[model samples]
Target: MDVSLKNRFLKSYFSFSVGIWFSAIISFLSVPITSWLIEPAEYGKATMFSTIYSMILLIVLIGTPNGFMRLYHSVEEKRKLLWSSLVVPVFLSVIFFGFVLLFKDTVNIFLAGQKNSKAHLILVFAVFFGVLQTFSQTVLRMQEKGFSYSALQIVSAASNVLFVILYALLISRNFYAVLYAQLFSNILALSLGIYLHRESWFPIKIDKSLVKEILAYSYPFLLSGVVWWLFGWTDRIVLRMYSTFEEIGLYSAAFKLVSVMSLFTSGFSTFWYPFAYEQYEKNPNNKELFSKTFDYISFLILILALLIMSAKNVIFLLFAKSYRSSAYIAPFLLLQPVAITMAIVVARGIDFAKKTYWYIISDGVAAAFNIIGNLLLIPLLGAKGAAVTTGLSSIIVFAIEKAASEKLYPVKYNSKRAYVSMLILIIIASINTFFERFYVGILSSLTGIVVVTLLYNDVFRKLMKSFFEFLNRLKSMNK
Candidate 1:
């Protein structure tokens, strides 16, 4: 890529990353406080509610967000495209809401894993608001309104923390605190999102043919979405069967810690999606740019993984004594976000070719592996088993998607380096999880970092060169 393109990429990435990183920092700060306020069992119950909410959101949205994003630039009638993308999902969500109300008893038992009518109703409304909020943010992302998008993210995260604290202290100190905080936070964020993007989506225009076309492209992902959800959440669901809510809570805590890695993944995806589609539209065979971007991202993600592993013990000290055991489970869960983020670049070819169904094959196989692994391993190893299963399943998904993407749109990525780095990551994670020696983790992580840096020395050299060039430009402009 040229210097100008590199500058644009960095500018856009940091714009998104600033908000995401702030949001992550706030969430990280709140984790210790929240874990103190709510017990492990309560946290586990809240996790269940979130899991159900995600399933409903997936079903009602029917992959419309992806469709809207994919077609945004291609379609001239932007407002109509927005309306068409949202109308069906809104209709489906309403129907699903009514169905949930009608079968409240069964849903309360099966979905929330508890019999609470108020919580069930709260969850139903959450899904409704979630759909609107999701699309509103998507609009901000597609328009490249990075500041507005970042503001929305910051507000959402901050508000959630405040609400959780207030609800826990003033109202109740149980799972309801978590659930109500999310519901209200969504309302606040959604309201702000609509206000921010009002001009773009106002005077909603619905086109029947446009709706059909968008759905035609997006509906396949509905199946893929289900399997993808399974791929991501099956470990937690299966763990619920073999373990106690306390174990689930510990596992969830570890997952939350590992989710900090999402700062990179979320920021990258938010910027990369629209950016990638726009670039591909301009030049279909821009393989070098894509390959180099992948290498840089992979290096960064691996380095972050090693650092997190090295600091696992120190980070876990923030949590309460009951939750500290989560340190053991935190290392491998890093793979989930790392793999998902890397796949954003490596798997763009699938979206570029519009082969949405390939998602099913990749996610389905990984989800299947997760289910079996959790079933067999959770019985013997409990939460650690689920963690191990998740790490391995993530790798499976990444490998399959990378290969498929190569066949469709061949990018000459340095696979040997990626694979070797991943191998080193697994070894370091294993040592950290199984052994209590702090020095052992530090030594392994340092060694892994050195080896990875050596493997990507070219990326480092190019980045250094770019930095000096950027500095020279600044100096000349000043003179």
Candidate 2:
């Protein structure tokens, strides 16, 4: 990589990542705090509300956010493109909101695990506002307004924490606190998002032909979205069926801890799509950048996964004693983000080639595997079963996506070392789960670290040399 290009990529990445890290830190801290305030069953019920919200968001958006990003630089009328993306999703969101109202009783039971009309209404509004927020964020993302985007993210996360504290202090301290806090926070975040992108999306007007074009590109993702949801959330749904809310709560807690991995994944994905698309447009044949990026990301994510797995017990200590068992479940759950982050890098070819349909096949197969795994395993092992199933399903998704992408636009990614590192991390996770001893975790972590370091020795040397050179440059500037 050129020095200038490397500097630009690092600057852009940190511009987005800094905010994500702060927001994630707040969210990370809040998980234990919320766990302390709410019981396991109540926390589990709150998780269900988010589950329903995510499903509705997926249906209403129908993948238009991605369509907008893909077409952003290609189109001259970028504002019109933004408006085109928003119109249909907002319309669909209204219809879904109405449906929620019409079928309030059923939605209440399914979403809240009980019939609370107020909570149901709040969830409906949350999804509605969330649609607007999605487009607003996408606009910032596509435009590379990293600072503004990061500010919005931080504000949203902070407000949610504040509201959760307020609700617990003044309002009822049950699942309602969680549900209500989310609704209020979404409203606040949506308002800020609209304000941030006001110049881009205000005076919005429909572009019928453009809307049709964007929809054509994004429609496959609609089917894929549903399947993707199934792949991601089937464990929760299955857990709801076969296990207690307490078990679900424990699982959700573990999942939240694992989501610290998403701090990097989400920030990277948010940046990757726009960056990758732009790079492809400029040099369609430059495969080395993609290959090198994949190797570096895989190396970082694998190392992070191992470290998190080793520290799971210590991390879970912040949770209430009732949630302590979550430590065991969290190690394998690390795979979910690892797969997602790497897939964004490895599967860039699919998006570049406009082969969105591959997502359907990849997610469909994984979802099927997950459904069967959950059915068989949740019956026997409870939350641990779900964690293991999710981990394995993630690998399936990554493998299928990588193969499809390679067929579309071949990149000679040096994947052998990544695979070896992943295997070592998996073994360490399994040991940590079964042994549950501090010394055992330490020994396994040390072993995995040694093996991964040896495997990626060349990459590490390059990074270290770059770091010292960067430091020398700083010293020269100071002089």
Candidate 3:
């Protein structure tokens, strides 16, 4: 049973991991051509608009998807629950978009919103597409069709490259052009998702009781979403608020670099809830399952951290002449994956407990910490301040969530190994932090990761077995 489960996870993990890398690759491919077509300022505006759009999405969805994940496994009431949970977000989305269409000017000055008054209508359409797109994709993720889901995502992503290249190179640089492309991508994704995972959505009906339960679960993120996004996005918006577009450009580049960590965590974390829920189903009372999940995930994060620290300089230097600032922040950014992985861990426990309120409260606290940190730090430190605040906030959040998870579940999180692993990471971070040089520290970090990875002989043996099995699976497919 364990072997089969582990194998499945490895396959799922690998697929999602490759999907992330592919998405990154496609984005890079589109970049030079797109940049040649549109000025940085225009591209920056589009990026900023999307960020605001995502923030607005929080209100429209009002915690539905997050709530859905938290409560779906517990929903005995079922169908009405699904319908009930979805209705509010959909209705609210329409209403909110309508308001934005109406009050275009007020949105910018008062709402901390975007300045693109002319593109407000297209923005609404894009946001609506985004909500529907998320709803459809969430259904597939819940169904555990990892390979099919990833393929659907890849198709949309690849299409994005085509459209971006076409629009940027051959068409207008109007923000709506980008918006139209995004809307099309979402439409394609929704279509592909519905086509591939037709089973879960069908015969779908409302469950009032289940809906209430899920809403209750999601209520936390709904609240947390607002504050969480504000803090998450505050640095960028604040830069626009306080500084010039040119300064915003530098900050945007740095922010884009850090978002890589989020991408890395997204797939793993997306699968995490379902994975945990499944384990709990199989062994409802097995503390070992939770402990093992945490350890395995922690170990994985450690490996990634080591790799990022090692490769930060070479990667940024290789990517673009303008993106040199990434090296300055990548090490600090690398530390973020640890906190992020732990946040997901906490979120998993919170999700399973059906205590959605805790999720909101915890996020609120973390958001508060970030906001205060940014306000105090950004004025003094600038772009680096933003990075520092983000990294520290992640750690603070992880610590808080870990405490909360411990309280609710009362399991050993295998912290002794975690502590040792973190100590090694800290040494690497400190070396870089002190010298503020990439090469020597990077080499040291790379060497340390190798030496430490070797320490777990049992782990290495298991990894080799898994690798061979994966290779064999590929070999059989070729036959």
lDDT of 2 by residue, 278-299 (tens): 8888888988889888877888
Residue 101 miss distance in model 2 (angstroms): 3.9
Q: How many pairs of residues collide in each model?
A: 0, 0, 8
lDDT of 2: 0.85
lDDT tens digits, residue span 42-133, model 3: 77667777777888888778788877655556666444455667777877778977788678877653332456455676677777778878
In candidate 3, how many Å is residue 366 off? 2.7
Per-model TM-score versus the true fold:
0.90, 0.90, 0.87
Cα deviation in Å at residue 152, candidate 3?
A: 1.8
Q: What are the RMSD figures for all models against the true structure?
A: 2.9, 2.7, 3.5
Query: Candidate 3: misplaced stretches above 4 Å?
Result: 76-81, 105-118, 168-171, 237-263, 319-325, 375-381, 447-461, 464-479
Clashing pairs in 2: none
Q: Give, for candidate 3, the lowest lDDT window spanning 10 residues.
A: 108-117
- Alpha-carbon shift of residue 75 in model 3 (angstroms): 3.8
Alpha carbon lDDT of residue 213, candidate 3?
66
Which model is ahead, 1 or 3, in terms of TM-score? Answer: 1
What's the TM for model 3? 0.87
